[model samples]
Target chain A: MTIKVAILGFGTVGEGVWETLHTHHEYIQKKLSTPIEITSILVKDSNKKRNLPDSVQVTTDIEEVFQQPVDVVLEAIVGKQPAYQYVTRAIEHGAHVITANKEMFAHYGPHLLELAKEHNVWIGYEATTAGGTPVIRTIDQMLQVNQIKSIQGIVNGTSNYILTQMTKHQNSFEDALLAAQQKGYAEADPSNDVDGYDAFYKAMILSQLAYQDQPNWDEVYLEGIRTISSQDIDKATIQGQKWKHVATIELRHGAPRASIQPMQLNEDHPLYNIDGVENALSIQTDLLGSITLSGPGAGKLPTASAMIEDLLYVFQKERQQEAQYV
Target chain B: MTIKVAILGFGTVGEGVWETLHTHHEYIQKKLSTPIEITSILVKDSNKKRNLPDSVQVTTDIEEVFQQPVDVVLEAIVGKQPAYQYVTRAIEHGAHVITANKEMFAHYGPHLLELAKEHNVWIGYEATTAGGTPVIRTIDQMLQVNQIKSIQGIVNGTSNYILTQMTKHQNSFEDALLAAQQKGYAEADPSNDVDGYDAFYKAMILSQLAYQDQPNWDEVYLEGIRTISSQDIDKATIQGQKWKHVATIELRHGAPRASIQPMQLNEDHPLYNIDGVENALSIQTDLLGSITLSGPGAGKLPTASAMIEDLLYVFQKERQQEAQYV
Candidate 1:
């Protein structure tokens, strides 16, 4: 089966997905035992001077990509505007969706899930939560029999990187943030990451996947590391504690609530050791008491790797469903 | 669809499985959306006094559990002798099997998987590796889309518990092992854990799953915490490192080989910060780059929880397969 894919962005993650597909295309095809081809790419700039193959089509009209009869759409676009429209339209056109857009999923996940179910297609956003960690797929497939009660951890790589540098090198918050930005872990305006808003969005997405509903996003009580000084780090070290920026989504009786902040971690806590750009999550459940996953939360290849994972997931699931017809 | 289940070996993990069913039977039924009832239990001593419901039958004979009309058989036994026999018999009878025996699976996994496939029954051994951490399930589902290159981290609790104590309290290896035994984390002899045999067995199991065949288990290069002194711990601390008993399975060209020993983990390593009795694994893959999972590796309830997850997976896959008939 040849699975056709259309990419809807030409930014860092999109270029990463493109490069990965080109570099590892043969290896991936051999593993899946199926042929996969990227048919079209939609970019804001028609002439971005990217080193893409001339055989593939590049267009600014997002609708043309969805209309090209592609079996899957990969959304690497950041915001919720055109991403929402393109994703919903792709689902409406009977195409499976793979997205890394957390903003759209956080606000409209339930609705998008409903639409995909109605259209009989899979909707995957594994990259929306923790870059490349397989937490979403693990929870979705493995622990289906168990009830998830909470998901707590460091969900943002920028904040984690900043905080880790601040504690390890005793750097100030500004210096750490600048270092993260220089390393491309943070954006020019690091408000979304440093102020805990980025983690807040990820928490919202996690709550929806684990709890089947939207969490109280506004009541999440977001606290950033802007207030965390070197003195605070020294105090924590002296008191035998580790400072961690944690985003937690708790489910009590099926109602979901969340909190994103910096907390003093005890010596025995798992997150106490999770430093830098390494992201970690502790999932508390009724059956499996707690399972933690930690890894790089943000990287070009890691983020693109997650998208490819979701892409394969959609195609594999479609194959399983189609196998029933035979 | 009523799924009939039989319990094999009424021991710690077995009792935990039974207790879990009794306490969360309703939740399991609702989550699975099917009727599940324990029909029989195979015990070493049939007349042993224990708290169990009157509806379930107890027997010392393995044939009684396998020859009966059961849909699934849960094997919570720890050894290779009767577990292999009961699993083979259950598979021959075309019944789905769930096991928590790492030794048996590590030795005879391919044979069991082939037998199950021939009989059109599922063989689930999620608890055979890292208990309750969902390592097997994560690999089976998520990494299916990606190429797994290496799996490295702690896979045993007793050794980790002792090492963590030594690192935190600056205790000697012998004292830490004694403390672990006092806290019920280690056995009286403590040879299996302290000698790295337990971790070697788990690495074999992980290698089997990751590569679908057992690697050279004898060449695993086993080194336990017994050889790790406080001097090594202090050296690691001075070098900004942590002493963790790490089990590593490296896969190349689809062949998986493993080694379990103590390594001076770098500060930036994800497993470096994972302390105490916690077990963590870093799965380096083509997709999802480097995904890590950490949690309680062993305990009555945690191991049983992994067994239940396997059972649920078997049930769901059974349902999905059976739905094709309708």
Candidate 2:
């Protein structure tokens, strides 16, 4: 059987997903038991020339792409409107959806997941959390076996990059932000990352997964590294500490409470030495104690890799269903 | 649909599996969409007053368990004798098998997997590798999406516990080993773990998953903490480095090579500060860069929890197949 996938955004992550799929087609097909093809792409500009094969149909109209028979929709697009419309349309058409859009997911993911279940499809948001770090899958599976006590980590790469630069080289926040922008770690408009909304959104996802409670984005505490100075770094350093933008969710009085702020971490913490664009999460559990996962918080290839995992999950389920009938 | 499971050992891990199944019965059923009952338990002695329900039949005869209609077999027995025979029998009997037997799997897993596939069965050995760390699950899923560049970290918890004691407290090798045994981290024999064979077997499993190549466990280079000394730790510390018994698989000359030896790592390496009984595996991939997961490598609940995940996976597949028929 063949599966068609539409990537609703032709940006860095979109290109990375395309590149990975192209490079590992045979391997992925062997694993999934069905070949997945990128048949269409929803881009801002249809005139742009990309390295994708001519068989791929690039389109600027979301409705036109939805108008076709699609099996999967990958929402790699930024922002709310058309990306949300594209995914809803795909699910309504009975196609599974995978997304790297954390901002949108944090807001309306539960409703969408309910909708997908109703349609007998799946909403895979593995790429929406901490890049390619399989954190979402781990929580959703392992939490069944163990009670999650707490979750703490650096979820924003831009914020972590800025903090690491300021702490390591004594650079001001502005210079560090500029350096991150040059490295493609930060966007041109960096409010979402530097002001800690990116991290807040990520914490929302983790909090929901950890406790099955989807908290509002504004309800969680938020603190960004935009105001951190060299003096703040030195003060933390002299006290045998380091500064990091940490997204935390813990059970406070038997209720889940979320926080995203720059905290002074001692060397004992697993996330203390997470430097540069790396992100790490310390998941405290009842059975296994503490499990910490560290990796690149955000990158083109890493984020796309998460999407590929989601696609495989979708196909694996479908294949299993087919095998059962036969 | 209903599934019947049998535990073929009443050891620490066996009891853990039973405990997790009993405690999370409703949750596991919800996840797998079926009611799983522990049909029969094969123990060395039925006289042991374990906190099990009266419905769980504890028997000393392995044949008695095989005599009953069983859908899955969870082999938690140690060593090569009855464990290997039991798993082979389970596969031949058309029963899915999940095991926490690393020694058995490392020595004979590839063959057993082939046998299971021939018989249309599955061998779930996630617990066999890194206890409840989910390293096996991560690699199994993520390898489809990305090329594994390298895998390195601490796999053997007993070895790591001894090394950490020696490094931090200047304890002798014997003292550290004693401390480990006292903490129940090391077995009475301790030969398998202290001789580096344990780590070697884990690496062999990882090597196969990373590159589909399973090097002979004996042929793989081995170096245990038996030779590690406080002086070695001091020398490494002088250079701003620390010692960790790293089981590594890197592509050398475009071929996968496995090694388990003590390595000197600076603070920047993700696996550097993983101390005590915590086990960590750093999977470096072409897509996600370096993803390091750290947690309890071996424990009753931890290892048993891994087995539950495997059982869920088995039943989840069964449910998916059943769903397809409808």
Candidate 3:
């Protein structure tokens, strides 16, 4: 079986997915038990000279890619409007959709899941929250048996990167932010990450899945790393602790109470040693106690790798279903 | 739809499963989108006084449970002979099998997986490896996209408990083992745990799923924590480290290289803070960087909770397959 995939945006993550498909094609094929082909690539400028396979139809127009038959729509597009429209349209056309749009998922996710269920297709946002980490998949499997009571996560990589630098170098947050930007871990704007919007959205997404309850978005509190001065870092260091930006949501009185803030973690805490751009989350469950999952928060290949996993999952699931009656 | 389940060996894990079914019955049903019932329970002594629901039939004759219609068999039996035979028979009888038997799974797992595939029924052994930590499920999902390059795990809870006590109280290994036995973390014959046989079996099982290649059991090197003395513990403590019995299997080239032994871990390692009977595992993947997961390694409720997840997975798969044709 050949799964036809259409890439909506050919940026860093899109290029990574494209490269992995070409580079590790044999290994992926052997594991998937099927062949997968990139049929179309959507880009900002089709005239830009880039090295790619001749078989894939590189086009500037999104409509051109949608015109072709697609089994899976690999949407690497950012933001809310077009990404949401693209995902819904692809699902409407009988194609499973894989996305890395955290903002779109956090806001309009429940409706999209309903649409996918209605269409008998899958909407995979595993890459949206924590990039390469299997935290989302782990939680999905965990929820089958254990009801998570609390979740504390260092979900924003850029904020974590900045904080880690500030603590390690004992420098100002501004300098740390600049270092993070130079390392490509942060963007020029950096507001979504440093202002806690990114982690807020991710926490919302996690709450939806873990609790199956939509929290009042306005009620969830958030604080960024901008307020953590060098003096504060020194105090935490003196107290044998490190400052970490955490996104947390816990069940209090059977309802979820959420917050995003900087925490002074002691040595015994699992998130204490999770420095640099490393992300870690601890889920306190009724039966399983405290389970911590940590990894690289985001990267080009890591995020793309998550999308690749979703693509394979769709095909494998269909195959199993098909094999059941045969 | 109501799914009928049978329980084999009403021991600690088996009783825990039964209790979870009764306690979290409503929540599980809602999540699974179907009601599940325990139809029969096979025990060593059927006449033993125990409080259970009137609906569940307790029996000593395993044949009686086989004769009755079963959709899934929950095998919590330990050891090799009868558990293996029961699982094979259940699969043959068109009932999906869920097992928490590590020894049996380590030896005959591949054969049983083939049997389940051939019979078009699911065989889930998630509880067989790391209890309720969801490592098996995570690895199962991870292999779809990420090729695990290496694994570092504190897999055995009893070994971890002994080591934790020895380091904390500066006690001898013998005294620690006695304390662990009193705490129910270790069996009276804790040779399987302290001798690293338990972790060895888990590593073999992990290699089977993660690599899809059978590692020769005899070729796999094993070292127990019994050799570690108080002086060794003091040495590790002076070096700002701790001793953890870890089951590690890494892909050296394209094949698996595995070993189970005590390792002195530094402070920054995620597994360092994993004390007591807690377990932590880190999977280094080709695309996804180092992802670490930690939780309760084993317990009555935790192990049984893993079996519950497997039970739900089996039902969910069946539902998806049934929906495909409709």
Candidate 4:
């Protein structure tokens, strides 16, 4: 069976997914033992003068892309408007959905999950958290046997980039931020990443997965590394500590609470060694004790790799569902 | 639809699996939907004193345990000979297999995997590596999308225990080994662990999983920390390094080669921070870059947690297969 996929954005993640597919084409083909076609691409500008394959149908209208023949809608768009409509419509049309949009998943994950179930499909957002770390898959499987008590990690790459630059290059926050932008690690307006909103959204997604529900995103307080000075880095170094931007999801009593903040972690802490764009999650559980997973937080190949993982899962689930009918 | 199980060797891992089933009884019920029943146990002594429920039939003869009404065999036995016998027999009997035995799996993994496929059942060995870290599953799922380049980390707990003891107490190798034996971390013989055979087995298993075939274990060199001195530890410490029992599986050109030895790693290395009985694996892949998973590599609860993970995978596979057939 062929799994038809629609790329809802032509951004970094979307392009990376395309390039990865092109590079590891044969490997994935052999592994899946089934064909997965990227059917259509939804872009804001149809004539953007970008190189796209002749087989891929490019359209500016979201509905045009959503109405195309597809088994799964892959949303790589940045924010919530057309992405929300396109995804919902794809699900309503009975297509499976896979996305890297943390903002949408963070806000409407449970509702979307219910929608997917109601429509007899699956929604994947593994890339929404820690890029290609497999934290989501691990938690999903682990939760089947063990009760996850808490999740703590460095979930933001921009904040981590700044902190790492401060440590490695003796750069101040402004210098680090400028350098990150120059390196294309940070956006022109970097509030989303540097002000902890990015991490907060990821925390919300993780909380949903861990608790099987969403937390109040507004109530989850965030403290970004915007205030972290060169002096702070020196002080942390002198005190044998690391200034790490930590996103945490833990149970307060029986309810889940999440927060994003920069913490002074001692040398013994796992997050202390997680420098730069590396993401690490320490999952404390009832049955399994503490299991920590660390990997690249964000990159072209990494995030693209995550989408491919979801594709395999989607195919597996589809095969299983088809078997039920047989 | 109950999974009838026979546990080989009602020892630490077996009892832990049993107790875990009881501890998270309701959760397992909800997840499995169907239940699991332990039908028989093979032990060295029929008169061996162990707390057992009435429904659990105990046996002195290994062959007798395989003849019982068992659909899955949990081989918690710690050797190569009888474990290989029981697992091969169980597969021939059309039973699934889950084991925590590294040595057995390392030597005969590919053959058993083929046997399992021929018998249309799964052969699970998640607990063979880093216990509850979910390293194997992560590789099976996540790295399937990417090419795994190299695997390296601290895979042995006993060696780690002795090294950590040496670092913490400033004890010599012999003294630390004595302390580890006293703490039940090392065996009375200490040959398998301290002599690096245990780590060798783990590296062999890792090579099989990472390479999708059995590596020539005989071609791999082995080294232990039994020769490591306090002076080495002090030198490493002075150089801001930590001594760890590192097991490495590297693909040189095309073929796989592995090594298990005491390596002094600097702060830049992930294994530098993984001390004590904590085991860690760093999987460098083409797509996701580098991913590291760490957890309790040994102990009753942690190992049992891994077994439970295997049980969940088996259950999920069964469900998927059932869905296919219906």
| lDDT head-to-head 2 vs 3, winner | 3
Better of 1 and 4 by TM-score: 4
Q: lDDT for every model?
A: 0.82, 0.86, 0.88, 0.86
TM-score of each: 0.94, 0.96, 0.96, 0.97
What is the per-residue lDDT of model 4 for residues B70-160, given as tens digits with 9 covering 90 to 100?
8888889988988898899999998889999999998899899998988888888998988878899999886668888899989888899
Model 1 agreement with the true structure over A1-326: per-residue lDDT tens digits: 68888998989899889988877788678766788888999999896687778768899997678667789888999888888999999999988898899988887888999999899888989888888887788777545556787788898888888888988899999899899989988999999988888888888888888778766656668898888889999999999998889998887665888889999998767678787788888888776777888777877788888888778766665566556567
Expressed as tens digits, the lDDT of each residue in B42-97 for candidate 3 is 99986789997787788988889977789999999989989999899999999999
**Candidate 4 DockQ vs. native:** 0.72
Give per-residue CA lDDT, model 1, range B242-295, as digits (tens).
888888888756677777888888877878767767787888887567778877
DockQ scores of all models, one per candidate: 0.54, 0.73, 0.76, 0.72
Ranking of models by DockQ: 3, 2, 4, 1
Better of 1 and 4 by DockQ: 4
Off by over 4 Å in 3: A253-255
Best by DockQ: 3
Q: Give the interface-residue alpha carbon RMSD of model 2.
A: 1.5
Interface RMSD of each: 2.6, 1.5, 1.2, 2.0
Better of 1 and 2 by TM-score: 2
- After TM-score superposition, the amount by which residue B239's alpha carbon in candidate 2 deviates from its true location, in angstroms, is 0.6
Output the lDDT of residue B271, model 1: 82
- Cα lDDT for residue B245, model 2? 92
Give per-residue lDDT, candidate 4, residue A80.
79
lDDT winner = 3
Clashes of each: 0, 0, 0, 4
Query: Which 10 successive residues of model 2 chain A have the least lDDT summed?
Result: A211-220
